[model samples]
Target: MEKIEKFEIYQRRFLGNKLKVMPLIEKIIESEIKNFNSFCDIFAGTGTVGWYFNKENLQIITNDLLYSNYIPLRAFLSDEEFDEKKIEELLKEFNSIKDCEDNYVSINFGNKYFCNNNARIIGEVRERIHKYFLNDIINPKEKAILLTSLLYAMDKIANTVGHYDAYRNIKDIPYKPLKFLMPDIDKRKNQNNLIFNMDANILIREIECDVLYIDPPYNSRQYSDTYHLPENIIRWEKPELHGKAMKFDRSTLKSKYSSKEAAKAFADLIENAKCKYILFSYNNMANKGHSRSNARISDEEIMEILSKKGRVKIYEKEHKEFTTGKSKRGDNKERIFFVKVKK
Candidate 1:
């Protein structure tokens, strides 16, 4: 797990929650990247799939809806140069000012997390870093790396069931990797990779690459709902705050990506994917099927959609640490769809 460990944020992200499909993703990527020259991670959550190509000197194009994700993709996967001293200075300044003021950080999640200090420090630091990023006050690559590191750090400190809900169970645990989170950041951000913050629907045939890895949310449960505080913390905008800082109006609801229309749209999007190989990561959750929300879709429906466009193969792996209760583990077996065509 050495290589996997290097992607620390990926594992930290699933702290107490369940995410069994990550290993299957590793398997397919290991096999596919062996022959590919470039990759396009359409829904690049955490940009873990793109990391596999970095060693090959291959170009990786990553797109995500959250600006928070763009920072890491640009820093680790794309950029080459950096300014260590400036980042260190920023880090020092951030820590020095961390406890002085609460501002947007505390307003968003001070009460939800057990580590109130963690949320407060993270908010202040994120805002300061973004100020440098937005005003072109510092090197873009440096800002990206700093913000990315901070995100990792803050996530480490956050409590609750992985997302933004208040921790009902109080655990006397300390956030490790504090040094990495509040790091001696760089001043110059790497810009070798192309990154964008946009709705997933905008992707089309024009974006070309050797492989496309799609990991859109499978169920109606929205990420914004679970991770609302961080959304505000990362954005640092502190928009008219509401109940628990949830910007519900701005959320890309489950209807947008979990509807019958969404399934057809996903098929159309995949068929038009400008890649030789396309891998879709999804689980048999409620509504995953064609009939209803959280309703699992059948393989036949998926195969029929892809048959006309390319060759299709299927794989399945049981999720790790699934609840033993018969009702819980029933839907834990996740499935992967590998659709490829000769280019």
Candidate 2:
């Protein structure tokens, strides 16, 4: 078994991820926008777009509401110092642990989201990471890296399709032991990058960037509910969970963009945005899926809201859609609304 470099930050199978359309996005920005210094991914899901545009001369700002996402943002983009050898040693130690007592994950999420043995290991490793951080044995960046490694590893082995909304009915889930891998972080570029765990609408007014990239949830599916398992593991609050999905109280984490008030939220966000350019990523699933899975903001509403800002241009690319259930997303085409904000 050779040491493989397989842990890239973009490897996760995240729904509505911009991994495939990244090239189209970059092409539009490079061709149209010029003399830009900062790129802000206000609703960065996996932090893929921000990291893709991370250049030595450009500043990167990424924000997400979930701690699971924010930790990875800090781990990959922030210029915090971390010990490499210590991290490698800790991974080896965690992988070798055979005896782990019953903990939150094992007790609550075992056999549902993950297999029992892997769930126990997850609990044990998360506890150790928390203890190490509290005891000052590891720096914040190191802790983030470790937690991110655990998250990526768990995402690989989870019994869900692409998100934790529901799990498949596998009576005897295979014994795929959790293995940690070091994230491929670019250490030498854009040391001034900033990371935040704040609401995107509130954050829009506080920050200014040359290029503001917006990729909000397109449907009623809230990311917090979808990724609750990872959120619980990262926050480690061990709160009371309910429902068949084993979800904790996420009242505060729900985004209005995923609700009926999506058009209003988009309007407010655009009204306060202080940027030279706005790049909005949306899809043509307005009427494709079920009522809950349909696009919250219609194309007409999006056009009307953005037209008031400045000149708007639309870019379309045919891409495959990611769905959770029987909902059909036929003939999906990602649309990027490029707006040059009025000065």
Candidate 3:
């Protein structure tokens, strides 16, 4: 294995990741708000926005339904104290693991989402991680950091088109040895950071911050379906797998924002939000692709819901959307609806 430095959370290929437009988002917030000490990313998919702001020393509160996203968010943004030197030593041990065991990941996902060898190793590593946590070898924060490293490593070597919807059909899947890298995060404890694995709409009412950034799913695609493999690995429930895609039941994790109820959900979220400013990210890809790929909430509905809250200003930047080789590509612009909340 080569001497790798560290893995940035943005390095992983995630659907709807805000890595490219992060600068634009920062600019909009910086220009609009004069003073804000806390930022809440309620629909923090990859924790990209929340993690980015954490670097700037703003108190960050992040919420996502999936444990896959929650674990990484905790790793990157949690202020809990951890031993960096011990974590580094554990990374070396996790990477040096050789003996592969036939376990849930190997039996269900072998030769599909991952190669046989890597799949077995993945199961082995996950089991070890749980054992480490169970026996008090690592704290919750430390466990998150370790699990995050495994998740990123799996994403890199998965045999799919940047998602877990389906794997490529071939006689032999590509074999890449499973390895862990240190998650690129500050060793110093971040201040006043909070993490949640909860539904965004329900969560919005309970949380308050200076800036509430909402980047809900724009289309009908459920993140649980798109990233189910990662969810399965992160949860480790080992439930029954179904279909060629090898997904477990994820009914509870579905977001209403991705359904026909998007407008209603958005309205409720806005009505209950307690914040000085609202930054809503929605793309102009309505009715552009197949029915499932089309945007659920309409522009009129968004404006109507937001107008009741406060004065709204719109910002636009042309950006390409991530597709799973199904949706049609066209002129798309990611729009941010910035609103000054009425006190």
Cα-based RMSD of the predictions, in order? 5.2, 1.5, 1.7
Instruction: Return the lDDT, model 1, position 343.
Output: 60
TM-score, candidate 1, is 0.79
Candidate 2: which stretches are off by over 4 Å?
1-6
Tell me the tens digit of each residue's lDDT in model 1 across 1-343. Answer: 1111122435446311223455777787677555776777777767666654454456678776766666676666655566656666666566455354765666555555635666667766777777787787777778776777777766666665566644545544454334343333222322345666666667656678787777776654555565565555566666775654345355453335655566677767766777788787666654323222253344566677767667777778875432212333334556678877666
Candidate 3, residue 256: how far the Cα is off, in Å: 0.5
Which pairs of residues clash in candidate 3, taking residues 3 or more apart in a chain or in different chains? none
Model 2 Cα shift for residue 217 (angstroms): 0.5
Q: Write the per-residue lDDT of candidate 3 for residues 1-343, one digit (tens) a residue.
A: 4454688878888888998889889899779896898999998988989888785567899999999999999998888888778888888887888876799999999989898889988998889889999999999999999999999999989998898888988779978877788888784536778899998888887888999999999888899999999899889888998999889999998889888899998899999999999999999888787777778899999899999988889999999887666667688899999999997
lDDT of each: 0.60, 0.90, 0.88
TM-scores for all candidates: the values are 0.79, 0.97, 0.96
Candidate order (TM-score): 2, 3, 1
The CA lDDT at 131 in model 2 is 97
- Model 3 segments more than 4 A misplaced: 1-4, 187-189
